[model samples]
Every structure is written in structure tokens, then in C-alpha cells.
Target: MFKADLPGLKEEVTVEIQEDDRVLQISGERNFEEENNDTWHRVERSSGRFTRRFRLLENAKMDEVKASMENGILTVTVPKVE
Candidate 1:
């Protein structure tokens, strides 16, 4: 389950697959949006870059991997090589 509090992060996210080494890399960054009004409040959300790397198996099809995000949920599909 790929869920992030970052709004409008679809364009900044990236998914890369290295077929030679069978390594998959997923990365993205979430920035803080400045609010017009500043009031005394508590901020628990943190802004930074996030990355994930996964090693694929020999039967995995790197070219057929698909990713989609909806309602802050990201789903990745990996097809096996036939």
C-alpha cells in the first residue's frame, strides 16, 4: 500500500526499472505548501524525499510493470516473463 499525505505528487513521482540488473526504483518528493495565514498550531507532517528499491526475479517482466495512483493509494502491477 503506497499511501502518502502529499497532495499533487503524481507528477513528481518516478518509477524506474533496470532490466540488466533487475532492480526497480521508486522515488518521489513531497513539498510543504505555504499557507497564507500563520496561526499557533501543531504540524506533524514532514516533507522530504522518499525512495524504494526492489530486486526482481529472473521470471519478472520489467517492461510490463504498471503503476497507478488513486485517492492517495498507489498500485503497482508486475507481470511475469513468459
Candidate 2:
């Protein structure tokens, strides 16, 4: 299982698994939108692409991997092979 705190990214995330190495990958991108009508005093937010990968154990069930995002949190569940 893996959990990630990804704020402002609801439906812009992607999860994948590598077939040969059994690696789990989670990725997403965020874009910053600016309104020209407003004068900005300070801008602290950022936007870019991010990716995280983890190697699965030998007992991991690659076919049953599941992922969900809720309230800016991303949860990935990888069941163990029996």
C-alpha cells in the first residue's frame, strides 16, 4: 500500500505498473492559472510534473492493483499474491 498527499490534483493522476520489473509508478501534473485582472503581491504556488516509483515485492499481485484519489490524497493498494 502507498499513500500520497497530492493537493489540487483530483483527476490528473496516473498509475501504472511495469510488466518486466514489477515496478509501480504514480505520476501527475499540476498547472498554475493566473488571472490578468488581479495584481499579484506574492506567488508561492508551483506547477509541474511529478512521478514516484516503487519496486514491488515478489509476492505482490500485479493484476489486482487498485488506486483511488479522494480529498487530494492518493491511495494505492497492491494485494499480495497467495
Candidate 3:
């Protein structure tokens, strides 16, 4: 199980498992939106593409992997084969 903090994002995230290798991949892109007549005194937010990969153990069941996002958090669950 893995959890990541991803705020201000919806339907912009993806999770996948590589078939050739037992690797789990999480990727997403954040774009900056400039509103009309918007003045910024300070800029602190970030925008870019991010990709994270992790090697799964032999006992991990890739077919049973699940992912969900809620309240700026992304959760990925990988079940182990018994």
C-alpha cells in the first residue's frame, strides 16, 4: 500500500503496472491556470509533470492492484499472492 499527497488535481493522475517488468508507475501533470485580470503578489504553487516508479516484489499481485484519490491524497493498494 502506498499513499501520496496530491492536492488540486482531479482526473489528471494515472497509475499503471508495466507488463514486461514488475514495476508500478504513478504519473501526473499539473498545469498553471491564469485567470482573467488576476494579480499575483506572491507565487508559491508549483506546476509540472511528475512520475514515480517502484519495483514490486515477486509476491505482489499486479492484477489486483487498485488506486483511488480522495481529499488531495492518492492511494495505491497492491495485494500479495497467497
Q: TM-score each candidate.
A: 0.78, 0.87, 0.89
Record all residue pairs in model 1 with backbone atoms less than 3 Å apart, i.e. clashing: none
Tens digits of lDDT, candidate 3, 1-82: 9999989987899999995799999999999866666576555678889999999999998889999999999999999988
Clashes of each: 0, 0, 0
Better of 1 and 2 by TM-score: 2
Tens-place lDDT per residue, model 2, 1-82, is 8999888898789999996999999988988766777677666767889899899999998999999999989999999968
- Candidates 1 and 3 compared: the better one by TM-score is 3
Q: What would the per-residue lDDT of candidate 1 be over residues 1-82, giving only the tens digit for each residue? A: 2233445678878888888888878889888756777684665666788998888889887778888877666777778867
- Give per-residue lDDT, candidate 3, residue 19: 57
Give candidates' CA RMSD values in order.
Answer: 2.7, 1.6, 1.4
Model 1: residues with Cα > 4 Å off, grouped in runs: 1-8
Q: Supply the TM-score for candidate 1.
A: 0.78
Q: List the candidates ranked by lDDT, beginning with the highest.
A: 3, 2, 1
- TM-score (C-alpha) between model 3 and the true structure: 0.89
Alpha-carbon deviation at 70 in model 1, angstroms? 0.6
Q: What is the lDDT of residue 67 in candidate 1?
A: 85
Off by over 4 Å in 2: 37-40
